[model samples]
Target chain A: MSEHGVRIQLDRVTKQYPRQPEPAVDNVSLDIPAGELVVFVGPSGCGKTTTMKMINRLIEPTSGEITIGGENVLALEPNELRTRIGYVIQQIGLFPHMTVRDNIAVVPRLLGWDKARITRRVDELLELVGLDPSAFRDRLPKQLSGGQQQRVGVARALAADPPVMLMDEPFGATDPITRDKLQNEFLRLQKELRKTIIFVTHDFDEAVKLGDRIAVLAEQSHVAQYDTPGRILAAPANDYVEGFVGSAAAIKQLGLMHVGMLTGLAELSATSGLPTVRSRENARDALDIMLRAGTSHVVVLDEQGDPRGVIGFEDIAGLLREEVSRVGQDA
Target chain B: MSVKTLDTAYQVTPSRWSRRNLTVPIGLIAAVAVLWLWVSSLNLDSIEARVLNAEAVRRAVVDHILLAVSATLLVVAIAVPLGIMLTRRWAKPLVPVVMALANIGQAVPALGLLVLLALWFGIGFKIALIALVVTAVLPVLRNTVVGIQQVDQSLVEAARGMGMRASRILRLVELPLAVPVMLAGLRTTIVIAVGVATVATFVNAGGLGDIIVAGIKLQRTPVLITGGVLTAVIALGLDWLGGLAERLLRPKGV
Candidate 1:
C-alpha cells in the first residue's frame, strides 16, 4: 500500500440546484497538495460542505473539472471513485445492526478482498483508531459510547486506506471534552497516514488546531483567505476574515507557537520560584501558567522534567511583534 | 453508565423456558383441554355425532392450518419485494397507486371477496386461498414500505459514501434495519390470515368452518360449540407462533 497522498485539483467547480437563483458553490477552485490537511472554515450554509462534498462527487459539480492524483474524477464511475476516497460525516453513521468489525470491513468487502485479508485489515483499523480489537470488534454500534462510535466511523472511512480523505464536521457532535480528545487522536493518526484531507467545519479554533492550511470561505464557497494558520491569525486577508479571526488574535497565534520558539531564555536559577511548562508545550500554555500563578516568568522543562531555561512575559510579546512584522513584510 | 444499564436490560436470560415464554402455550393448552372435557360430557344425537367425529374434525383443522400458512407465505412473497421496489427512488411515483390498490383489496369484505372469486372462478381451495391472500396482504406490504422508509437516511448516505451500491445498501443496511417493523406487520398478517381462512368454508373449501356451519344448520349445540372453540384455538395458536417468529427474526441491536 502507498502511504503517500496524491494531489487533488478542483478547477472552477460549480454546483447549481434546479430552479435555484444562484449556484450553491460558484466556481470554487482549490489546489490541495499531497499529504496536507486543508480545513475549509466558514459559517453554516456558506457552501463549504457543498464544496468538500463535490470533491468526492457526493454532490456533483454542475460544470467544473476535479482531478485526484492527476486522474479525472468525473470520468470515473462515482461509486468506484468514492471507494478510492475516504469520507466521514458529523453523525458518525455506523450501521446500527452491524458489529464494529463488520462496519469497518464494509469497503474492504466491497473491493472483493479475501476473507483473511479483510479480517486482518479490520482488526488493524480498530487498533489504529485507539480501540481494543478484542473488546470492541464484536460489539454493535449501540453498545459503544458516542466517542467510540465516532472512532469506528473514522476507521470505517479509512478502511480501504484511500489516499485522499474528506471529513465534514467529524467531531462536531461530541461534547467539547470528547471532541478535543478525538481531535488530538485524529491529528496523531493524520501525522502517520499523511493522507490528502479536506476537512470542513465552522469552528475556527478547530481549524487552527488540526489544519496544516486553512481556507476561510465566505458565501457561495468563495475563498476569503487560504494560508497557514500562523499567517491567517497574524494577518487576516480582509474585514470578513478579520471578523472570523475575532479578538485576541495574538493569543490565538501563541497557541500555534511552542515555548522553544522564544530564544535567549534566562537561566533556570533566576526563575526558580516561577511556574513550569514543558518545552514542547505551546506558548499559550506558558502564558496560561504565568497568568494563573501571577508570575512574570515560567521555567521551561525538557522531556526529563529538568528545567533547561526560563521564559518571561516580555519574551512572548516580543515574539508576536516579530511575527506580525514578518507578515507585514510578506504582504 | 446509562448505556451499560441499557445493555444489561437487553441481555437474554440464560433459560429459554422463562415463565413469560411459556404462558401463552400453557394457557392455550388449558383452554383446549377444558373444551375437550366439556364436549366429551355431551351425550350427542346422531347428526351431532356425525359432524363431531374425530376424523372429520382432524381433516377440517388440517385444512384450516394449511389455508392460513399458505396464504401468509404467498402474501410475504408477493408483498416484500413489491414493497422494496416501491420505496426505491425510481419507483417512488408508483407508491401511492399501489397503496391505493392494496387498500381496495382490504376494503372489500372478506366474505364478499371469497364469494366473488368463487363466482368468477370455480369454487374450490384455490378460490379460498386467493381470498385469504387478498384480505391479509395489506398489513405486510404497508409494514415493509414504512419499515424501509423509516430507516435513518444518514445511514443510507453513509453506506453510499463508503462505495456501497444501492442493492448492497438495501441488503446490508436498509433491510436489516427494517426487520422489526416488517416482522410486526407479518405478525398482523398471520392473525388476519387465520381469521379469514375460516370464511374459506363459505366457498366450500374444507376448514374448521365446516363444523360451525354444520352445527348451525343441524341445530346442534354440541357441534356448534366444538366448531367455535376449535377455530378460536387455531387462531390463538397461530398468533402465538407469529409472535415467536417476530422475536426470533428481528435483527439484534435494533
Candidate 2:
C-alpha cells in the first residue's frame, strides 16, 4: 500500500532434488533489508534463480523458513501470497490474445477491482513504463516489438502495486541497446518506488550496476561472497567468487563510487566551456568526460546546472588505489 | 520541396466501385436463379406424374439442410468438451486411443456406417443424424486439442505466477487463443457434413438424395441432373458460410 518496501528473510533454506548427489541449493541464509535491492548473481544452474523463486513460493523450498514483512510465508496459500507480490521473467510473457490494457490489469482483475479502478490503474501503468496509454492500450502483444512488450511486462507486474518484486532477468532477452535503455528506465522507476526487489541475473555487471548489495553464489547455491558491490570487487572471498567476477575488477569498482562521494574535491569557477557530468553519476562517466575533453578535469555539476567541483584524472585513479592499499595493509 | 509539387503528390486516387466483396453471395444467388429457371422450363410431365415434382424438390432441399445443421450442432456440443478433457494431464494418455476411434469413424464408408446404425435404431432421421455426427466430429475434436496444447507454455506460467486460478486462466487465456484454430476445424466439419447428409435419402430420411435415387429408379435424366446440381450448390454454400463465421469470430490483431 505504501511506496516503501518490505523486508524478506530466508533462513537456512535448502532445496535437494530427488536422486541427485548434491542439493541444488545448499543450506543458505540471507537477510534482505527493507527498501533495498539485492541481486543474486551466479552461473546457470547455480541456484540463484531457485533462491529468488522460493521467495514467491513459485518453487517451494525443500526445507527453510521464509518470511516477508515479519509474516511466515510458508504458512500462507501460494496463490494468495503471489497476488501480494509482483513477478517478472526474462520471456516477457504477455498474453497474445489480450489487449495491452487487459494484460496489465490481470492482477487487479483477479483481486476483483472494479471496472473503473482497473481501467485507471492500467492506463497509469502504461504511462509509468513510458508507453502512451491511448496508443497502446488496445493493441495485442503480437503487435508490439520485443522492447515494447518488455515494458508492458513490467507494467503488468507492477499493476497491483505490490511491495515486493521478484525479477528473473527481466530485460535479458532484448538487444543490447534496448536492454541498456530498459535498465536505465527501470533504475529511475526503482528510485521512485523503492520496492524490495530480489533480482536474479547471471550477468555480474548488471548486478553491480543495479544492486545495493550483491550475493555471489557458488556451486549448490552456496554464498561465495555477500557484500556491497564495491567490497565484493575489492575483496572476493575465494577463487570461485573471483571467477564469476571475471576481469576488470578495478573498473567494476569504479561503478560503485558516485561523483558526490569524492573527498578532497577542488572547486571549478567556470560552469561552461567544459564537459559536465552530474553529481550522482559514477566515476566511469566522469572519467569518460575527462578523456573526451582531453583535459585533466571536468566540471561536476550539482542538482542545478552550476558546477560545484572538479574531478581530475588523478581523482579517479586515486579511488582504485584507495582500496588496494587498504587491502594490502589488512593482509 | 516546392508547395505545388507537394500538393500534387498528396492527391488521392479516385475510389472505384467494386462488387468483389459481394462476389460469393452474388454467385450463390445467380446459381439458384439459373437452376430454378432450368427446372421450371423442363417438360417434366412424365416425372410429375410420378413423385419428381417441384414440391418434392423443395421438401428434399429443406430436409437436406436440416439434417446437416442438426448433426453439426450435436458434434460441436460433444466433441469440444471431449477435446478439452483429452488435453489435461490425466487425460493426455488417452488421446491416441480416442483419435484412433475417431479415425475408425471416418475410415468406414458413410453408407456402411449408416446401415449399421439403421439396424440398431431402425431406419429414420435418428440413424442419419448419428451417422453424420460420427463422420464429421473428428476434425473439430482433434483441432481443439492441438490448438489448446500449442499455446505458448510461458504465457500459462506467467498467468499462474500472477495468481490466476487454473479455471480463470483456461477461460481467459487458453480458450481465446485456441478459438481461431477451433473455428477452422468447425468450418471443415460443416462442409463435410453437408456433403455426407445426401446419403441419408437412401434410408428414406428425406433429402436431395431422394430425387436422385428416384430418378435412377425411373431412368429420368432431368430429375437426376436437378438433384446433382442442388446437392453441389448446398455444399458450396455451406463452405462459404463457414468461411464467413470464421472471419467474424477471429480475435483482432492475431
User: What's the number of clashes in each of the models?
Assistant: 0, 0
Candidate 2 RMSD to the real structure: 8.3
Per-residue alpha-carbon lDDT of candidate 1 for residues A154-220, written as tens digits (9 for 90 to 100): 9998999999999999999999999999999999999999999999999999999999999999999
DockQ of each: 0.68, 0.49
Give Cα-based local distance difference scores for all models: 0.88, 0.84
Model 1 ranges with Cα > 4 A deviation? B1-17
lDDT of 1 by residue, B57-172 (tens): 99999999999999999999999999899889998778778877887887899999888888889898999999999988888888788878878888988888888899999999
Q: Tens digits of per-residue lDDT for model 2 on B117-219?
A: 8877799888899999999988788777776776778888788889988788788888887777787788778877888998998678999888888878788
Poorest lDDT segment (10 consecutive residues) of candidate 2 chain B: B5-14
> Model 2, A134-174: lDDT tens per residue?
99999999899999999999899999999999999998899
